[model samples]
Target: MFESLHQTQVIPDFDEDEVMLEDIEVEELHPTSTETEKNEWKKRKTRVRSDVWQEYTKVMVKEGDLPVERPKAKCNRCSRRIAADPNKHGTSPLWKYYTSCVKKHEANKSQTVLNSDESGSMINWKFNQDRYDCVKMYLTRKMHLRIFSVFPPAMCGTHLNLVVERGLEEIGMLVRRVREAVKWIMASPARSEAFKDTAKLYKVETSKFLCMDVPTRWNSTYLMLESALPYAPVMALFEIVNSAFVRDLKQKTHNKKSIGVPEELDWHEVRRKCGYLKKFHKLTEEVSATSYPTCHTFFKEMCSIFTVIRRMEGHEDEDIKRMSTRMKS
Candidate 1:
């Protein structure tokens, strides 16, 4: 029973070197029959190999089989082929193909929805937390006092949205600067004395200068003057003053040429010919040597009054223009 169990448990080991039959026994078999069978077996083997080759070719064609070539460099974002050479690609440590791809994707996505014009540039200011906060607060407070004086708290937000959307950030800054200019002017003893006497008439005549009134030549002058005031910044003020001076010079040159008069003339004659020159000369002398801050402060205050005027007119640009035309007349 044990011997039978051992035989049953034994497993066959198929070795290539092991002989299946002795040579003599194999030679005894029928040679013709064996030859025929061997030939048929060879033919079957060839057919099997052929079939495998055909199947492999079909698979190769279906799967787009190609040689394993070296990987080429490419821009991840644009999928544009790049040079394989490291030097050609750039050697910067921080440079990354994947990062650029992601960035390009994001930019394209944003550009698709956002405006791509000059007006769209204003969005950057909105995203700037610090700048937006300061400007928003300043404008909200100031605008509320002027235009939105009767507006409820709920309406204030709506007004702010309208202003911001209308690109009034610069206007808000202008108003603030003008308010500062007024303060400076009031603080200066010389400026106050020189202009204080003409304050009432100036107000009436310069009413067109107010942002609320119709914009006119005088309004433009006031705008330039307030815009140039030292409190705003020497650079800004200089630009304003320089522009005004150049414009005035051009006008004077034209007038002289038109009248066929000489460039050089006596002061009294000049004053008589151009009555505004006398007043301008007085204001110029008072402001010419003034500190940047003092001039800016005065300009700021002047701008504030304009802001008030603009608000009073319901923020109508047409009204400002009409008022300006009247002032010029």
Candidate 2:
């Protein structure tokens, strides 16, 4: 295991006047050099603090009798020196040079990703668990370097789904009954066609064609409910018409548990629960429409979800109130 900061070996460009070197004592080597001469090359204060600084050392040269700092940044991994005038060009040259060095070093070592366009180049360097553990063990625990991690704001679809999942439990019975009813109708091509005929018979326009929910995503559950709710009357009549098929399903290979149809009470519960869920579904659609969504939009949607759930906490129904309160917690 490597202990100290890692450095790479790079070849120097003979054409350039700049070269890589470590600190050297002028007085010890050249007794004629005075203390005042040594003090002349005192290291200048770095105006900007950057991680790139860790890789390169400033070359100190002697002009006759005095040691002077050169306007150059040298790569530790290689002898290549870059022209770095902080006052004039800032650290731009140093950053660009380091980026190239990283690219070459990573490629030579068969490491994946990392190389340009300023900060964009650093995006691909995968900092997985091993690197994370090393930072914690050597840096933080050893107190050698203080590292602060800046995390991006949490507003992904995963976060939204997680937030909605608990609230869904409140109306699990209603969801299950509706899911079962939809599942029965959509079980086979024959049954699906029959359901479409029934929808026409009742003149109920099923938008998603009896789409069901995937267990992982709650938006699908909301969609499943959205499509199924409009066909409440259709489902009731269809269930009665196909009672024998449903009975046979239970006796045969289908789920042995009672695939109960959504009753009036279940439908009522679904309607009430859908009020908050619709907000999530709409926001989900808006967010999904764009490949990249702004954090401001996510912030507004998050606040909207919070408001809906908070309002539900004060709902007249005790079950809704309890569910909302639990979800808020």
Candidate 3:
């Protein structure tokens, strides 16, 4: 959304996550004329931006005021109009208005900005550190952090999911093949029974079926791989119990088609990937404690992630190295 504003209008560029502006109060929406832009702008929303408009409103003023017909932001509280030209300086002026001008604004706005929930409740949060620090300083003294205030140094659990998703993309084909294999097994009662029998033959636990991952949730994929890795040795034995699925993959491999079967190398890759992810999965579980502060523990988990990424960067596989490099960048 911010990128679109920068491309079409004279505004600063921001990542998709950066422009999540929060609206302070719900105001009447006077729809403006439609545009002819190539990109569909209506679909996009900027949520985190509400704080900027909490005390101001963007309104057009006459040409006589500034020699040019320029837009001005009218203070919602005081009805004072200020220059709002979409230029290099984006919303900095408007942000400075409140807390500095209105005495009530200072009283209403929190310096520490905990914005936290009831004690012991886990909730999703998002905030950039630079922005949070700047806002904190603007509202109060430097390093005047309130005791018990929790602010994560890294992305929160939900945002961390985006990073995990991208990393998972590095092994998308392998994941898909595993998913297909699971589907082939669980989609039929007979195949599932054969799987249990095969597991029994290999002395592998037949307590659970091969998990099929939910595409939207990364952890499901982790669970899927985690369960399937135990059956890696027995996978070749699946050819004996379930030759049809194996035969199909063999034919595809022979005919220059994409391999949709979990092979030895593929299982090896899954095991390694699962090892890396299992740590993060545990971190998320720990950080998910909402009743108490998890921020302190979060930093330690971040260190672990950094260490893991560095190790992955030095791995023998080029694919793993490529993935870690992307994650680092």
Put down candidate 2 lDDT per residue, 192-271, tens digits, no spaces: 88777877888876455678789678888988898888988887787677785457444433234554567788888898
Model 3 per-residue lDDT at 322 = 80
Which candidate gets the maximum lDDT versus the true structure?
3
In model 2, which regions exceed 4 Å deviation?
1-156, 245-259, 287-292
Evaluation by lDDT, superior candidate among 1 and 3: 3
CA-RMSD of model 3: 32.2
Best by TM-score: 3
Report every candidate's CA lDDT.
0.37, 0.71, 0.74
lDDT of 3 at 162: 72
For residue 205, what is the lDDT in candidate 3? 61
Q: 1 or 3, which is superior by TM-score?
A: 3
Q: State TM-scores per candidate.
A: 0.20, 0.50, 0.51
Q: What's the distance in Å from true for residue 187, model 1?
A: 46
Clashes (backbone N, CA, C under 3 Å), per candidate, total 32, 6, 12
